[model samples]
Target chain A: MSLHLQPVRVATSSDDSESQLVFAEGFLVAMLVHLSEQHEDDAGRWFLEAGFGRIPSRDHPTFLDLDEAQTWIRQQLGNAYVS
Target chain B: MASNFTHPLFPLIRKLDSIATLTDEERQAVENLPVRIRALRARHEIVRHGEKASQCCLILEGWACRSKVISEGKRQIFSFHIAGDIPDLQSLHIPLMDHDLCTLTQATVAFIPHEAVRDLTMRFPSIAAVFWRDTLVDAAIFREWMISMGRRTAFDHLAHLFCELYLKQQAVGLAGEHRCPLPITQGDLADATSLSNVHVNRVLKEMRGKGLITLRSNTLVIEAWDELIRAAEFDATYLHLQKRAVP
Candidate 1:
């Protein structure tokens, strides 16, 4: 399944506004927020703000870039499909 | 250790005195109890889950916490302890541990044998009542924590915890003037509140932006105590301190 990302803005009530909506086969799957400078060492990283179906909610992991995020999302979706 | 330190058990006396009055004879009895003092580094485990303990550890200095680790090695901190708190007090009766107790900072702890504690309580019924009362207050605090974890928002939950921590330390003469040593990290806060570290950081920034509080260098300064209390809807009745400390 191909994954697609669309840039968007999330009203996180903090400096982290830049975000992207991730879609798996045109189905919205996750929302990733760009870490703001307020995050200090983690600034500029991508944080999994929220995830739907097959994507874990408890583990809001951060990635160095969108590619890494997609890789993780694909893995989750693959796991869901395989099981 | 103080130069004029009369006994190593003074911390325990001070702690008990915070909630209930201790008679002179009871104080002397506590002072006379056998103790083993040891200094430990941060993150040192004093007691592990499922271990049968023969003694209870009392925090003489620095901080400790009762916590449990679940799947994926994620830890949930149940309580933060300060000087004079016996985080493992239940071990005196329940020899088998249900959770882990560890130091959050460099600490000096005194281990009191269960036999001595049991003997002290049996001989001094009033002290036994005080200990029972202390456990009751502990349960009350747990109830409050349940409310925070289950119902309160992350912001409100954190605010409530800060208020509780400050008040607890103040009652023990370890904090004052709306300021307290919050030596734990944001990760620690996340575990205690059951929130993600990112969420904790966001709330902290929001709090700072609103001029509510300032956390830096392991010290938390309540910039607007009344506003924070109002926001958290904090009521200190659960703490059950006999003589309430200042705000």
Candidate 2:
């Protein structure tokens, strides 16, 4: 059977303002998050390692908060998921 | 008689012969059909969506695909065509194009008028039956694709596509020995398979690691045909090739 993305609940840390929205499908887990400044470098490295690229001059959009990150994830998923 | 290769309907004749035999008179009629040949560059649009087509585009050389651009400029490719294939043959009856037909490589195309096609079909019932059968087979392929998208895994879908394409090219004498020309990009494959480019690359890597197939320099070589077929659960019944290869 084909793998399909299923959205999991959004999680937020009490000590930090950083938010993560997780999506799961079979053995794959995709995490979309509003990266804090300390985590930006690590996130960029991870994105590059994941083939998303991390060229400094590249115009990759950065979301400042959870709502923007959630919207971006939704847009990427398109009609692949229900609700 | 001079060489049949010199005939205007050579590609069409070869195509029909792969599906059904034609009488001498029917062959003559096809040779006499009016056509305007055009050479197009890769990515050139032969016909656009919402356009009322007056002629059908027949691929004499190179490849073409029918696709639709959806939201976010994401294009979904429906079918690929090669020599002896009419990418827009449905336009003869439908009149209006609901999707775009474009070249995937530098291509030689013959534009046959719908009026002429209609006249030919009316005069030759046997030839008309062949064309009808061709369209029916096209529908069958579409159904198979829908099944692939709805039920098959990405690896299975890619394997199935490779199997189908190889058989198609082999039927037309363009491929043999489990190898075929695959002049399409990872992105193109992604569009056709409804997967992302990254995912396609990953799947291809997995296939390579499994020793199932090798795709390089626009050529795909099936290293283990039986294994690839098994992975895909592929059956060529829907393809309807007259001279089907035993797998």
Candidate 3:
């Protein structure tokens, strides 16, 4: 399946007021979360909390670093990834 | 041409046509089958578990379902039926009902005596084969549901069900363009999917948030057909529809 992600700009006031959050839409958020699984390694078992909706939100720890996570997201999105 | 409402057997013919071809003589025989038409309110039981049924209930209009109640009064819905579906056809051979068949909405049903169905099958062997195939397809669907319940996540199982229902309705010309009448509640879906009502609600919210489907007021529209199919890993082969084209 092809999932296209388009950036959505929204302003909000939070505890981290100086921080800006970029939300993306068009990803199959539910499917992606269902497909992801917890992994155990030498570092121990880690949980990944992939959020739903147009913008992908993650609060849980990840096995993949920033670059790797971006690549994985791009791969899951197929040719639909904009950036 | 007379309206289908004039012929009580037209729905059966339409259903069988999706799986098998019937000759003109056979069609005439079906058209001549005697039936006792009844109007039933929603939630009424047509056949109760352990009861001996002398007739088969063919849904002429509205939705019905087969279900079994377990301990604690929890119900497990086996399948949902629409117009032209004989929800209790197995009763012709089994005699005793193992589960309950009930109306999901205000329904019009045609109850054909077992003797008449038996005579038709005896006189027309080809028609008998068609009926046999229909029962076998029912078993195939049961097997698929078993797989979904055991192996698939709630999301995938629900998506797979939507695909199956849509295709089945489309085969009978009741649905098209990824939209169909669902007429089911979240509680009913929870029973069918073996999930809690809260879980079903959350999953439905996720589905809507992702724009995968739009379900409202007894209607469901698949917004992303290909994505839904992929998520469900759905294939229409199990349905065994003869005319696969979407009309």
Local accuracy by lDDT, each model: 0.89, 0.76, 0.74
On residues B1-247, what C-alpha lDDT tens digit does candidate 3 reach at each position? 2544478668888887776676778788888889999999999999999999999999989999999998768799999999999889889999899999999899999999999999999998877887887788899999999999899987899899999999989999899999999998887898888765534655776778789999988999999999999999998888888643221
TM-score, one value per model: 0.94, 0.77, 0.73
| DockQ, model 2, C-alpha based | 0.06
RMSD for each of the candidates: 3.1, 9.4, 14.0
Model 2 lDDT tens row, B46-129: 999999999988898899999999876879999999998987888988989999999999999999999999999999887787
Candidate 2 ranges beyond 4 A from true positions: A1-83, B243-247
Off by over 4 Å in 1: A79-83, B1-6, B243-247
Better model by DockQ: candidate 1 vs candidate 3 = 1
Model 1: per-residue lDDT, tens digit, B46-99?
999999999989899999999999998999999999988888888888889999
State residue B165's C-alpha deviation in candidate 3, in Å: 0.8
Interface RMSD of each: 0.7, 12.7, 13.1
Comparing to the true complex, what docking class would candidate 2 get?
incorrect
| Model number with the top lDDT | 1
The per-candidate TM-score of the B chain, in the order shown, comes to: 0.95, 0.96, 0.95
